[model samples]
Target: MSDARQYFDLPSPFAMKRGGSLQGARIAYETWGSLNAAQDNAVLILTGLSPSAHAASNAEDPSHGWWEGMLGPGKAIDTRRWFVICVNSLGSDKGSTCPASLDPATGETYRLNFPDLSLEDVANAAQALVKSLGIEQLACLIGCSMGGMSALGYMVLHPGGVRTHISVDTAPQAQPFAIAIRSLQREAIRLDPSWHGGQYGDQSYPDIGMSIARKLGVITYRSAMEWNGRFARIRLDPEQREEQPFGFEFQVESYLESHARRFVRTFDPNSYLYLSRASDWFDMAEYGNGNVMEGLQRIRVEQALVIGVSTDILFPLEQQEQIAEGLQAAGAKVEFVALDSPQGHDAFLVDIENYSRAIGGFLARI
Candidate 1:
């Protein structure tokens, strides 16, 4: 693992949040710029559900990550000024040790046998990586969607480690509405005949179920206004599917299919199950013994910024507002920015300029 600068092995026998420990546990991460002599210029970026450690173009990999529009030398979270590090989540299929990883004890993929995981585990793993890098304090920790939850978890878990926290399009806890959607996504994957209790082996996978789930996710990630504006009633040519109902004619169906196909090809089905469930299981209030403010109060960060998009129904402006209020109530300096955009929950990734402005300005102050 040391041979590959992209991967880091946590000093082995890493303990998980639920129980049990992983031997030879490894984390995949990408770094930009240089860590200063004091190691105080580090910025940790936690990704959403599907992004990899490749958060932007760098020397090793020129390809841009999902947040290409916002991260780079001169962009928001500028690598020119801060040593930015992005780590793939612990349970992610992208290069990280996940359900798809080999089980050293049995010489088989962990699959369903992978231990129960949670957002706390995700935060802890990233923290471990930071410590291993010899970073005593972070200039900032940034997250969006699931990453946002991880950022909050970092604050609660290690109160003084991060100097600032930036959360976008996320909440302290997964709302029931969001949980219901994710539960359905998991159900779709489990119901696929090929899943075979997550023991499909080398045979075909649950592509149908995984594809369906991704489609469902696309619907939630994008706003109805944006879909209508982009797709409208546009129909696939009648020659494409003569026997199909007119309802399937919308271009949106084609869009969903294309995106889902891309996702199902690379993502591991079991990893999806674990990570999605982990997101729902995260609840700061529970950590606070039923009071969110209590959990927020535990965070000792110098300041925080929360950004919300108006069209994000999955995690709406109200949720971000509450996060800011909780932080304020906890006596932590906080700033909440509500943005109006058509991208819904995905605005942070797609509508880059808005996020760049808010983030860049905030980082400047920090």
Candidate 2:
């Protein structure tokens, strides 16, 4: 509400959690509503892997964002009551400094040369932005998926920066199954001849492999029940299948194709590789000598909320339970909410009303 989307320039030679640092790094972000006189009503919203800083409809941009259904004036986030700040994660293709961005040293895109990124880097960059805004504490810090992992990192890195923490449909670390799936997805891209070991400049992108990878990803993001309910035994016309070499008999296959096509046009293959690997590289327990509860002990929030979808095999309800239990064991107030839905790992994205109601109720208490 204060202004449209904006950029925050991080201090030069940006340091990373890993070894190297980046030069001229900047983060793109958007804000909604006004910061109360106390600056205590600001809410930090972190997105999953592919979303931009545009979390919801705002004055400058009215288009719907990935979380459009749950944000805005009277929505779950309720911009009318709280100032919302959504920062595009570093290494994202969307407006943030990334592999696609030019290296200030060489005047060319970093591409594969970009330093390895980690969830800590994302959390640090966001915290820098918050400090730049002169905000002392956040009313709540909320995230979904990869964002949730970042939220965990933020809680540990800056223990007193946020008062409430909300993590939705994400695990504290990438589970083995999730990592294996993403490994194959990365393999798909590298196996593409056009990918040229991530230097595919001027040549055709690895669209074929990217598409295949996305198709596989779709399966993991959704539940069997949802697929069955939506595309039960439906088949495409034989003639249409013949016309399109990649066409499939099942409507579910077509759904995957549509999403893949839409994604490749906007997402950069190298950035995808980086972000996916970053997720796998994140492990919350590393903060406290491989003990999750020990790591959680570093968190200084008044309240914590963990939400998990029953059908989410990727993140799983058990993962959320782990987070809540760890917080409680560490002497923090915690609430664990289990949502039943057919949407699987993506329930937070698709089952809007359920998530909205749960999150809204939590925010009200905050």
Error of 2 at 255 (Å): 0.6
Provide the lowest-lDDT 10-residue window in model 2: 238-247
* lDDT (Cα, tens digit) per residue for candidate 1, span 208-286: 9999999999999989999888998898887654375654566888788889989986898999999999999988897
RMSD of each: 1.9, 1.3
Model 1 has an lDDT value of 0.87
Backbone clashes (count) for model 1 = 0
* lDDT by residue for model 2 (240-322), tens: 46465664877777788889999875888898999899999998789879977677676778888899999998898998998
Going through the candidates in the order shown, the clash numbers are: 0, 1
| Candidate 2 displacement at residue 216 in angstroms | 1.6
Q: Cα lDDT for residue 150, model 1?
A: 90
- Score each candidate by Cα lDDT: 0.87, 0.88
Which candidate comes out best when scored by TM-score? 2
TM-score of each: 0.96, 0.97
lDDT of model 2, residue 53: 94
